[model samples]
Target: MTTLIETFAALSDPTRLDVIERLMAEGELPAGALVENTQMSAPAMSRHLKVLRHAGLVEQRVAGTSRLYSVRPEALKAIADWTMDHRTFWEAGMARLDAHLALEEGEGE
Candidate 1:
């Protein structure tokens, strides 16, 4: 299982996040395909991919000479689980803020 820190760190980069979103939308794709339509060089993209791979956010498969990349479902699930676990904390904070704002408005009336 991938730690939340690693997963978040890898996704912190915009390029890396885009890569993950693209892979999720388009399914598995060759490294070459990932390089297309981007201003970044293949080497730079490769480095980003390496970070993602190390984070266990993506898996690489070798099809002969090509390297294909795909998002790992479990990695996403882990993130979702973490977020859900903290949902109540956020909801409570929001609720308190709303109540505070209501009190402030009433005070001004």
Candidate 2:
């Protein structure tokens, strides 16, 4: 439960989400690559990575002088699927709000 909260909280930040998205699509990346992709400083990127690490949203592997970060998709997918299952969640709310609802919503607006 705590891990789930931490994982969602970790991705709450835009920079961390950017890091996660880039790494997921591109595979493993070093700090420099993440920094370049995020346009954040080295220290800032490091801090974001730290938050992600603590949340179990990401894992790091050391390769020579650099550390590479990668997405743990199974854990992420578990969180996503769990959140998807809860009807009260914002994701579900949005999902429930599709085009059909929008037509009816126009009468109230």
Candidate 3:
């Protein structure tokens, strides 16, 4: 799994974020396939992949002469876990706001 800081930093870029979203949605793809339909140059895409790989957000596999890329499941799980850790805070805040609104509506009636 990737360190939280590194994972967030890697995802902070729009291109990198899109790359991750694509991989997650489409499953493993050849590195070249990732650049298809994108405006980024091959070299630029390659650099983004390298950054993700270093951050442990992506894994690469050699298939013949091609390199296939995919999102690291553990890295994604780490992110989900981090967000879940804050779920209670947000849920409680929403509950309090809902109650406050309900009280205000009652007083206005």
Candidate 4:
């Protein structure tokens, strides 16, 4: 549970979330590659990566002189499992919202 909270907190930052998304989309990438096309400096990106690594959301590997990063599958699985576990709650809320909207439309008719 604590790890889940940490994961969510790390992803709350836009830059960190973007880093995760990019890493997922493009396989494992070097730290330098992750820094490119971003307005932030390399050091700033490094800090974001550190936070992600600490959260267990990403894993880092050393290849020659570069630091390669990739998303940890287990972390993603945990998120998916948690969401699915609460699927009933979300569906119920949406159903209630739809019923309310339908009633409002009928009143206007």
- Output the number of the TM-score-best candidate: 4
Per-residue accuracy of model 3 over 1-109 as CA lDDT, tens digit each: 4589999999999999999999999999888998886998989999999999999999999999899999999998998998899999989999999999999999995
Question: For this target, which candidate reaches the highest lDDT against the unseen true structure?
Answer: 1
Query: lDDT of each model, Cα atoms only?
Result: 0.95, 0.84, 0.92, 0.91
Better of 1 and 2 by TM-score: 1
After TM-score superposition, what is the CA distance of residue 50 in candidate 2 from its true location, in Å?
0.8
Q: Can you give the lDDT of residue 28 in candidate 1?
A: 100
Q: Per-residue lDDT tens digits of candidate 1, residues 1-109?
A: 6689999999999999999999999999998899996999999999999999999999999999999999999999998898899999999999999999999999995
Off by over 4 Å in 1: 101-109
Per-residue lDDT for 1-109 in model 4, tens only? 3378998998999888888999999899998998896999999999999999998999999999999999998888888989999999999999999999999999994
Question: 48, model 3: CA deviation in Å?
Answer: 0.3
Error of 4 at 36 (Å): 1.0
TM-score of every prediction relative to native: 0.87, 0.75, 0.86, 0.91
For model 1, name the residue pairs that clash.
none
Provide the RMSD of all predictions against the true structure, rounded to 1 decimal. Answer: 1.9, 3.7, 2.2, 1.6
Indicate whether candidate 1 or candidate 2 has the larger lDDT. Answer: 1
Which one wins by lDDT: 2 or 4? 4
